[model samples]
Target: MRRTMTRLGTDTIRRLPKVLLHDHLDGGVRPATLLDLAAQAGYQGLPETDPERLRAWFTAPTSGDVVRTQEGHLARFTPVLDLLQTAPALSRVATECVQDLAEDGVVYAEVKVAPEQHTREGLTREQVVDAVLEGVRVGTAKARLFGRRIDVRLLLTAMRQAADSLEIADLAVRYRHDGVVGFDIAGPEAGYPPTRHISACEYIKRENFNLTLHAGEGFGLSSIWEAIQWCGADRLGQAVRIGDDIAVADDGSAKLGQLAAYVRDKRIPLELCPTSSVSTGAVRDISEHPVDVLRRLRFRVTVNTDNRLLDGTSMTGEFTRLVEAFDYGLDTLRWFTVNAMKSAFIGHDERLELIDGVIKPGYAGLSTEHVGAAFFRMEDSW
Candidate 1:
């Protein structure tokens, strides 16, 4: 076995293969693409038209320790969603999303799309789904031409505050064999608990499809409990608040509450997005982030980029933050990648192929002294 490596750098992190489970379609528009789309649609709601300025504007602010509601933070996506009201715009966004992930070293990703939000301009939800899938097809082919391997799938999402979850659930199942792979309930997590969409969750379960709910964000442990115990969620999104159920002794050891114990014991994967968690007040800051603790406790913890544009984060960026904050190594990164692959909605054979064939070898090659003679740190200490 390859020993854990130290001194992993940003360049090394960028080369590592990644899997993303919880990302929003409307939240990750590239600034340049957003500008072009807005121009075409004649929508003038952008906060900044200059790509650099717009990027900084969209980047999550460093709101230290001040807890903010998710609704307010989510309202920022209005302009991007407005631009995606048409099929051509939706397809272009999806295409670029895959291209962007491929360039960022995401080999497999499941992006969430709330088609209901894009239907205001006369496009039916089915048309929206079809357009996005077409974009996925085109983007995958383009990536292949560039010698990049990536498989991007869609997760049909329903707003937690909406009453059309069952309809979204049906849409997900309708395209399960297509580019669609899972169903999710996103949007505000405050008053609209997962139980509010139990019918959709139950429908997904009865169909034997995958479900990952946005929990432990606006709400606390109760939200997580409902998503898992009540709704049978296969994974938890931004489950940072799970720390609420863990108590630490003066010696730095942890005592898990019943819910925390249940979550860990069941290996329910937590799609923890540190940067976004801090930006949304789900976490105070990177220093207080519990991902390292959760990983040490053997919880199924997978790092992710919640909203790439909004958080100014990618998978590698999230890993870099953890490495800088907690002194994580190549092996720790591998653990998170493998956990995400296992938690993916794809079939076991597909996940195994990527893990055994792609992810493992990629890390093994990087860990070797032969490959790292130039940049990677070879010492035991940072």
Candidate 2:
């Protein structure tokens, strides 16, 4: 029997309840808000003053070095990070981040931020955390007003090249009862291995806190090895290169090497960012991403929008592309959502509540004109 094509539309995918585990707060500031904040702070570093042009300027490169590909992706966040130095700016950014995610049908999300990067404007690290958390509070409250309910938390990041991992880890533990849920190390992963931040990882483990490491984006399998085996990471951020450890013979039989086998055997969650992977040159294109192979192999994989502004993508966009590329339907999308919820840093009961209560039933709504959302109203679903 021939296989029936399982196609999903962007409209339907947009309405499905999403659980996002990887998102950078600073990389997703609203354009209009950025302009308003610039005026309030008297900052003049914007490449384009107009909101539309400024939004384009972030991911567009008209000049020699401003390209938007892997080479120019990191440059897009320079001005954003600089603009987010003050407490108010951080809070507003966090608030809008939640609002946007909620609007995109994301019911649960953990937005990551590096507090050390935002301290240049005389705000203490604690103040930075406080401001972001405050914004999360306001954002959640505002989402309800719009008939959208979103739960957002923060994951404090430490620069892998810096000596502040221990400090950041301790800070995350300090706010465990608050909105902060986990600690992470992110930077250039080639020269700065995860082993370098052993103290922080150990500290988080000892404190019984959550830990995820950024690895295998611009590097190779060794970086992933160190992240999983050395640092004891609970999840692998941008672990696109873990696919390299799998080898295929001429007859099309695939084999997993020791490291890859270990990763798959352990069911370590991989926070795969397809669009950002292409933007960062981790993979040439979304169709070429390892997510398909990894999924077929039953690897613990989840989808994420790494930097919404830089990639000009969202959780919905990511799912749309995956559906288009792989011809996936509701089952495939649900798998990714459940993987994210299970891998989330929140407590087991909370995760189960969302997985069983919101995500599954929301997706079960009859497919109507609006991609499975017509039968279930936002207010009614909750």
Which residues of candidate 2, in runs, are more than 4 Å off?
Answer: 1-6, 61-72, 249-252, 366-382
For each predicted model, how many residue pairs clash, with residues at least 3 apart or on different chains? 0, 1
Give a tens-digit lDDT track for model 1, residues 5-104.
4567889888888888888877888999999988877788988889999989877553342555577678778888878888888888899999999999
Model 1: colliding residue pairs: none
Q: Tell me, what's the RMSD of every candidate?
A: 3.8, 4.3
| Cα shift from native, residue 293, model 2 (Å) | 0.3
Local error of candidate 2 at residue 102 (angstroms):
0.2
Instruction: Give me the overall lDDT of model 2.
Output: 0.86
TM-score of each: 0.94, 0.92
